[model samples]
Target: MILIRARVEAVLEPGRRTEVRVPVLLIASDRRWLELLPSQRARLKGRFGTPRSADLLAAVVVVRGPPSVLGPPSPLQRAAETVRARLRRSVDRLPADQRGVLPGMVVGDTSRIDPDLAEVFRTAGLTHLLVVSGANLAIVIGAVLGLCRFAGLGRRRAPPVAVLAVLAFVVVARPEPSVLRATVMGLIGLLALFTGRRRQGLPALAAAVLLLVLIDPTLARSYGFALSVLATGGLLVLAPPWRERLRRRLPGPLADALAVAAAAQVAVAPVLVMLSGEVGVVSVAANLLAAPAVAPATLLGALGAVTALVSLTLARLVVWPAGLAVAWVVWIARTAARLPYATIPWKGGGLGAVALLAAAVVAVLILRSRRLRLVAVAAMAGVLIAVVGLRLLAPGWPPPGWALVACDVGQGDALALAAGPGRAVVVDTGPDPRLVEGCLERLAIRDVPLLVLTHPHADHVDGVAGVRSHRAVHAVLTTPRGPGREARFTSGLVVRQALTGQRWSVGDLTLSVLGPLSAGPRLAPGDDGTTVNDASVVLVARRPGFSALLAGDVEADAQRALAGSVPAVQVIKVPHHGSRSQDPAFLAAAHASVALISVGRDNDYGHPAPSTVDRLRSLGSRVHRTDQEGDVAVVRTTGGLSVVPRR
Candidate 1:
């Protein structure tokens, strides 16, 4: 599915026909929009509904049958569309991740980016690299101005050439709100720099903001708009002073880069803290590491886009250098994201923003003295070393001899069954890739002999990418009743159907597919949540002096069916997050010593029902809930078995 912005021409309201002028979001399955320009008119037959977020859009039109083309787009728009298509085709030879990022960095086209890779970029606070931000426009304008200077052109002549470059970039990148905002901010900064009149920059920025908000009032509420303005303000106001200070000790180029990155990060910290509830500890460093490559990648990608209009072969050659630069950026983001405590979780909302702002003010006051600045730097370094040291020395987490871990993925299931060093059998990746991936990272599991997806529900399998990211999986075993939509994440892997009585082993650990006795019964062609729940693939995992029942989400009916065959074990992953629809006979049959429940805190579904918890306790089981304990691990003890809670 693709989403496009469209204007509403008419409305049919019961007996009245009304003509209206309003902007709306259009959801369509048609590929025609790829060829159509930004403002082209089209006749669409669809049902209108209230938009989820009505901040920018009046309504959402979901295209039902087909879209009717009213007319062709303008000549310029057609050329731009052609250039975009050609550019995409030219980069076909690059690696999948690089190919996706190049277009995004150039023209804000991100349809091809891997979701897992996008998550990594987000975690590292490098998402700006994948968008048409002020940095991109700054690079383009800076390059153009440098060329004019290199040719010995006068400053007066350089502005006109730079203005042309800005216009062309806006057209090629499509005059979306973000692109327009970046263009305006970039031009203001250019004007300030070229004229050597830094004081006028603020008034120009204020006028630009007033004009833009008046033109499109919705931009006032947009986070992107706010960030663009703040970043530009920081560059004009804070960067110059900081750059001068840094140049006293550092080289000119390094000082400039550090000042820009630090100013932008400082300006946007409050907003980011409130929005994401986390502070990116490594963001400034990540941006600094990525800054050198941004200019080359953006310039080359744009050049490639233009060259594609003339010759696809030449465009491919031009894009190769851009690909290498993008690869470096990708590496930086991935590496930074993997670092310990890359982001520090904090309070969210207005309170968090206010608290962070206050802290920043205090920090700035303290760092004004040279001696204090040195002290602060040393303190921060010491803290970082301490964190790394503790992480390496900490023996409390992923406790030794741990055989099974129910990761706290929130309202979903993800379990790592240890096979050997850095190897495990991952089952039921949770609803998010980041949460599950973080759990695996903490456990230091990099190689997976088998990935068992109990069912095709999103909660059971949406995190498949996290399991495969920076790791190797020999095979994937899933239930036979897999739907095409949820199974797409496992596309490149060897996926096979898990059958009853099927057995597999890796190292000393062994697994047997127990239940999922039958396929989902035939029903109407809609989401049959119950039927899917019943078809969850149940497993019995065993090792020396340890065993577990990794019951996916099978409810009452399937639980009753498996009761006769399912044997008692040391631990059991309570079915369906311990919902009330459990079979007492099945619970009695297991008689597990420890029961693990994976559910989210304050979830709307009220999972791990009170009655279910009581029933498990009555069955002579000690319950360990992930929502309470963070990550519940069943480790082997010298005498018998014990539960470890990494809270």
Candidate 2:
């Protein structure tokens, strides 16, 4: 699919006749539309729809067959697109991750970035590196100013060169609100530098903000714009004082780096929390660790893009060092993201912002006192040591002797039945990739002997990339019916039809597919997919004294069909997330010691229906809902089976 920004030249209606310049998102399947450039007009045949709350566009246009070119793009846009294409080609031979990252770091072209790596970048809080920001422009302007100095140009003459560099960088990055904000901030810095007055920085910043906001009032609502302004303000208003304090005890370079990272993180923390609903505990460290390579990568990438215009060979030569730099940055992001507790969940929205600001105030006030500062440091150090000690010596996650784990993936099913150390049978990889990936990582699951996708529903298979990102899956099994486009990520994998009476063994565990006695029926793609839910692959896993029936989202009809085959077990994954359409006799036949229900909190669909919970309870089974607990695990104990809830 191609997403294009276009204006409404005319609205198609019974008698309407007008032209409007409103922004719209055009979704089209024709590959030819991908060639369209910014500022070019297009005659689109589509149905106009209202934009969703989260969409940035004013309207959504679903285009038919193809687009008709209305006009050619301006010369500047054409040149920029050509330069971007060349920059992309410059890193054609680099490592896969580096090739994707270099262009993104240089010109904000992220089309080539792997989805898994993009998620890793988000988790590591290194997402900023992929986008064009004040940092990128600052590096470019700094390099240009240094070059001017080396060329014997005085400071007075350097500002003009820096201005040219900023404008050029803006064009390459696309003149979006965020890029424009960065450009203005870069010019403000150059203004301060050319005038030889450090104090003018704040006034220049204020003037720049005032002018930019006046020019585009919508920027005030842009998150990227806010982050860019906050980061630049942090560098100017907070970094100098913090650096002076750090220099007293550390080397100049280390102090400067630490100060800049901490200041930016501090300034953006509240907004970041509001945006992501999580606070990056490791972002400052990750940024500082990756900072050294960013400049070389940015500068080299820019050089490569420029040189590509002359010779592709020269561009490749310049980008070779850039690959190494990008590799280092990617490594840092992956390593940092792999750390447990890399980010801590925080509230989102207005309350979260106020809470963060209040906490910052308290921290600052305490740091102002020498005695209080020492006490605070000691307290933080003690807490950190205690948490680390617990994680290493007695990590509560993935409890030992675990037979099965139901990952809390918010209204979806992602379960792991242990096969051996760092190996398991993963089933129904939840709705969100990151959520499921985090669950697998916490379990230290490195190998999957078998992956069972119950059905093609998005909640069950949208997270395929996360599961396969850094692990080895020997094989995959799914229902007889093919999955839809939502499960396209797994299309490359060879998937076998999971038939009734099929069996597989890995390590000490045995798995048997036990349901959908027939090939089942097919429904239109636009249907509610309840028939597909009934066609879910049902399996029962057994290991030593532990056994559990892994029921997919089968409703009552499928449950009744499998009633004769259902066997009594210690645990049962409540079908359809315990929707009201459950078969009581089928549930009662399980005779389980534990009933694990996976569902989301405050979900639109009232899952884990109270009736289902009561029915399971009436059967003398212990019920555990993932919405209440973070991850629910069933562990074998000497006495009997015990449930461990990770909250």
Candidate 3:
């Protein structure tokens, strides 16, 4: 029954397009097991359905509890809801820094996790503490065992008590995928302990993984699932040998902690690098300091939270201890985050990650002997130093020379023009700060003489923070017009708008706004109590023989209005990410040598419509999209134009 329950819980349903009407069969069996069979897997589509289209035709079967309960808010749902509510309340009382750690520690609720903090945790190499995995369970079991021994509990009775404790912990944590995965791993660890077979850990971990994947084939695509499995496997396979080696040089306890941290990091680093495109050089050092605090903090926090729920007065007494633990974690995160270059950005994808992992494996194999280990370590350090040295001594940006870059910012538009040397003029700040920052970093853009915001849309203005953070802006230019169709600068960058419309020189480039003409109508603040796309600020930049126009999110009406008034442009940043709202006359009049589109991948709005691309192509304009080429750059040359892609 337990095995069947585990299989059923692990199963992922096939995808369904809609809530199709299908017959469901319920089979009742002894030992209180109920099986649900869907008549047609094709008819069961929804958020809970499988993620793959091919899987939709597969059988949809679920086995849980008894036949009496087979509907919405299944047993798992009911339990998760109760746990989530309690977690929400507990987190609400914690400081912002500590709030995110709770869900991760208790049940792996990453929904509220902060990206920056998560990065720090990863860099500091303490990410395992955030997940309720085998390590967490081991800590709990070990503590319980120690307590039992102190209380004079019999060894035989202790196992039963530990099992019961495990069950209670699972219930409180809720049966999420991570919790279930951890529980299975924990149970196996306990079984190994009881049988006095330490070597059983690897086999148990592998078996658990196979069982999980077999039950839910969809987990193959889940990064979290892969990371959890790999981290656990790494610990099981590498920690022992690593610990043994470390014990020879350091105190037993310190060596054990360092080995555990190193093993998990070695196992998960490839995946983390692939997903994040950055490596934490300081992760090992950070985790060394943080390791001792995680267990006590989590245990105390959990106990205090549970006690507070039961008795407010008693909860207050425990809060101090809990607070101290939380403070330690908070301190670790802040300190790690403050370190310069804590995370070194790297190029990532499947190939890079695989190569890195292969390298790690080779390095590990080479470490078997003391002499080779020292040599391997020295070689690795040398390689790192060489890479850093080359990067620092490199003549100019990887792909040197001037270029105009169109940043991928989803539905908004942002283009950067490098006049010559390190001088540049920026037009539009993309909708997301992080995305824009990534684009700038790729281009090695440092200083901006003019920061032109095409008009304020959250998409265009949100990336202003990124600009302010990375580059020195002498002046900003915007169409005298305020936010066109939506609330402007809500993401905390609006305060920097004071320099709008002020012209600034950056070495040799000049930037200025062309429209949002003071005489134009107040852009018909739409029925939604805001202006529409027609009011976007349009920018025109000129430098020697090079010229470009940055059309914000302006629609056809504004495009037509501007076409009759503005001067010819050599390059055009297609308005509204090549939305169909563009005026044909405007495209023809601009006669741009190049057209740039800033759009995100798989965006729902279907930007850069076929017709718009065709129109620009028909006019002898070369069109480039950020989605395909990453940051697109156009540099002015005495003879003509030079193009570069961040990719």
Candidate number with greatest TM-score: 2
lDDT of 1 by residue, 501-521 (tens): 999989988999886885555
Better of 1 and 2 by TM-score: 2
Count clashing pairs, candidate 3: 9
Determine the C-alpha RMSD for candidate 3 after optimal superposition of all C-alphas: 11.6
In model 2, the runs with Cα more than 4 Å from the true position are: 1-19, 25-36, 40-56, 60-74, 115-124, 148-161, 188-199, 338-341, 370-378, 396-647
User: In order, what lDDT does every prediction score?
Assistant: 0.83, 0.85, 0.64
- What number of clashing residue pairs does each candidate have, in the order they appear? 0, 1, 9
lDDT of 1 at 247: 100
lDDT of 3 by residue, 279-385 (tens): 67778777778778778766765665566566655654554455567668767877987675677666566776887878777876886679888887898799889
User: How far does residue 42 in candidate 1 sit from its true spot (Å)?
Assistant: 5.5
RMSD of 2: 7.3
- In model 3, residue pairs whose N, Cα or C atoms come closer than 3 Å (at least 3 residues apart or on different chains), thus clashing, are 13-50, 14-50, 16-45, 403-634, 403-635, 404-633, 404-634, 431-459, 485-531
Query: Whole-model lDDT for model 1 versus the true structure?
Result: 0.83
- How does candidate 3 score on lDDT? 0.64
Runs in model 3 deviating more than 4 A are: 1-94, 110-114, 144-168, 171-177, 191-199, 345-347, 361-647
